[model samples]
Target chain A: MQSIGKRAAMLGVFSGGAILLGYVESLIPVLFFVPGMKLGLANLAVVLALYYFGPGDAAVIQLVRISVVGFLFGNLFSIAFSLAGGFFSLAVMCLAKRYGRFTVYGVSTAGGVSHNIAQICVAAVLVENVKIVYYLPVLLLSGLATGLLIGLAGDETMRRLGAPPKFYDAVSNQ
Target chain B: MKHRERRLNRWDMALVILVLAAALAGFLLELTWTGQGASLQITVDGEVFGTYQLDKDQTIDIGGGNRCRIEDGAAWMEWADCPDQLCVRHTHISRANETVVCLPNRVTLTVLGGEDGEVDTIVS
Candidate 1:
């Protein structure tokens, strides 16, 4: 129980760090290469959480980040989009981790792609026009590209973060 | 455990190459998708003012109000009646991240993925 408590505390810290990174990234002025397009810096934290922790923990972290950050930034209207993106990305990665014939990086890529697609779906719903769905192909392609980019980065980050001491012992015992 | 990478089969390679080719084609053809230089017809309101075309002398203004111009296959809102004038100040949009918004008019224009044949508009 003592060890478990310590581990939970560690996860809490990690979650806080990830959210801070997300918030900082959000503060930067958006640079759009095309109309209504933006580089997704904050999603890096989402990738990190997915990589280091189980998807459930990642989902919790994302929910916290969205709520806290959105509140601080007065982005209440964006909450639905964030929730839609977070749920889809986390769900996809969780399933992939359990059964897909892929590595963490591939799962991370899929998560990134799913996150963007889900957000766009929410946008289309809010806008109430199918024409808004026309953004699909381009968004998907960009998500694919960004997914690969973030996946590669997440892979490197996970490798560098090293194994938690307790986690290592538990896995070896299993 | 070390992360695994799936080996790309020939099929995967072929598909990747095909998608890359399509993206290239879309980027080149994007000039034709919207605006005055565009060969495709784009109607404003009830009338077909003009299609996307880049020819400075040949371009037709849409809605008989604001002007959206096309140059070398890219589109931009060059002028508008909106006070903020953010749309007019915006750089010509060719990439997916660009957009033009007329707050007063509630008109939002964006160039979709003619560059990659996929459209990614607003992300969460």
Candidate 2:
């Protein structure tokens, strides 16, 4: 298992992985949901943050990634959507971290679910009609599934490294 | 580490199934909710020409030069003195805020959907 510092470095690595995932997902062409939405693998960094560094760091990392990705490959409209999803998911994960044990998987799951809901809400607000709310039930469904998988991945990653909260020490400034 | 966790709780399974169902429902709603607030407003040479109601049939006189029957919310030039007969080829505008411009006769068709008129403009 990589130390937290290396894991932090992995943030950049995961981001590269995520960028590749994003482009690949887009290329598949056929969409299960609205044409605009995607799996957002870049969130792996956010998942890593909550588990290794703490929720605050996780939130900051997510914000930075969202901003950079928006500027690099997105338009103004997409940026707004990213803000809602990324911020909401991070906040949810942060809160979950307080109540739940330091399980990286669970935190990541919470973040994933919250991210999709916020994005859907933003879309509804932008269209100036709640009629778009019909998309909510589906969004929730997708969120739940994706969240679980993301959370599980984080949890397994930690377990395999034979590390717990102590793993975070690698990146701990103290 | 990401490739390993294949086991998921029952809740996880339910969540995925539920979301897939909801997505299908939303797609169906989109298919049916094609209602719009306005239709084709065609103009020619600064003259008050005609209007078209979508999903229905009608006709318009384009400044006495072209006469077209309005079929399916579009004005096709049934008869035109203009060359190329492009005005007659105008397709119906089902989407909101879309315009089919006919430059040869200086006629334009614009489709306005939803309550754009009542709602204040925010941003494009």
Candidate 3:
């Protein structure tokens, strides 16, 4: 396991990276022309943490990033939808990674699809309108596309970053 | 390290295929399903304010300062106090279970009276 200081430093870097990418993502206009839809560039940081630091650290990164980013850049409703999406996506990715069946890309794609599905579900509940579910098809397609892109980026990043010194490889290997 | 060494594999391809299949399924479902609402159900701030028949053309002054016109078998936002004119710009909707929502005003006009609408009404 890494020292406490090293862990904190890494977490800080990941959080910063997530926020920066989120900003970059917000700048890009989606092809679908829908609010709250993007490349999900922030998840790149989450993917990196999940692969490099293990799910526990990855989970922490997810929460901190959402809260900080949502508080700074988004509103309460956006935060709620993002939290719902992020939680489910993280859970699926962690499970897939731990199972060791799918590669990084597969795990990331699962995260992406689950993220959109969960977000739409929350939207439906909030609006009290099931017609919101009509947006699912578009969300699913975009999620797949973005997930694949993020996964590929994460794979290369993980390969390049390698493992940290004193890394808890055994724990993350799960 | 072992997991890291394992890059894209057959399993990864399988997962991609599965995701694509799911996406295709959703797309097809959306394309094929048609809204069959018989009436327009207006909701303001999540409350059922009124329901209007699609067959009848009428103008409505929805509570909370929103106005909509139903004409030619369709309903559309004629006026709204909301900042964004998204609801006003939305095309007339006549299909069952279709909706034109004004997020800022918390007004939703949903098509009611189809099979799905009946089920939704019961559930809501």
Predicted structure with the largest DockQ when compared to the true one: 3
Interface RMSD of each: 6.5, 11.6, 3.2
lDDT of 3 by residue, A3-112 (tens): 67767877898989998898887676445433235689999999988877889999999999899888887777567778999999999999988885887888898899
Chain B TM, per prediction: 0.43, 0.50, 0.70
**Model 2 interface CAPRI class:** incorrect
DockQ of each: 0.10, 0.10, 0.35
What's the lDDT of the predicted structure labeled candidate 1?
0.56
Per-residue lDDT over A50-100 for candidate 2, one digit per residue giving the tens place of the 0 to 100 score = 666666666666666666666766656566778888888888778767865
Error of 2 at A144 (Å): 1.7
Sort order, lDDT high to low: 3, 2, 1
1 or 2, which is superior by lDDT? 2
| lDDT head-to-head 1 vs 3, winner | 3
Deviation in angstroms for A44 in model 2? 1.9
Candidate 3 Cα misplacement greater than 4 A, ranges:
A33-36, A163-174, B1-7, B35-39, B53-94, B100-107, B112-124
**CA shift at A6, candidate 1, in angstroms?**
2.0
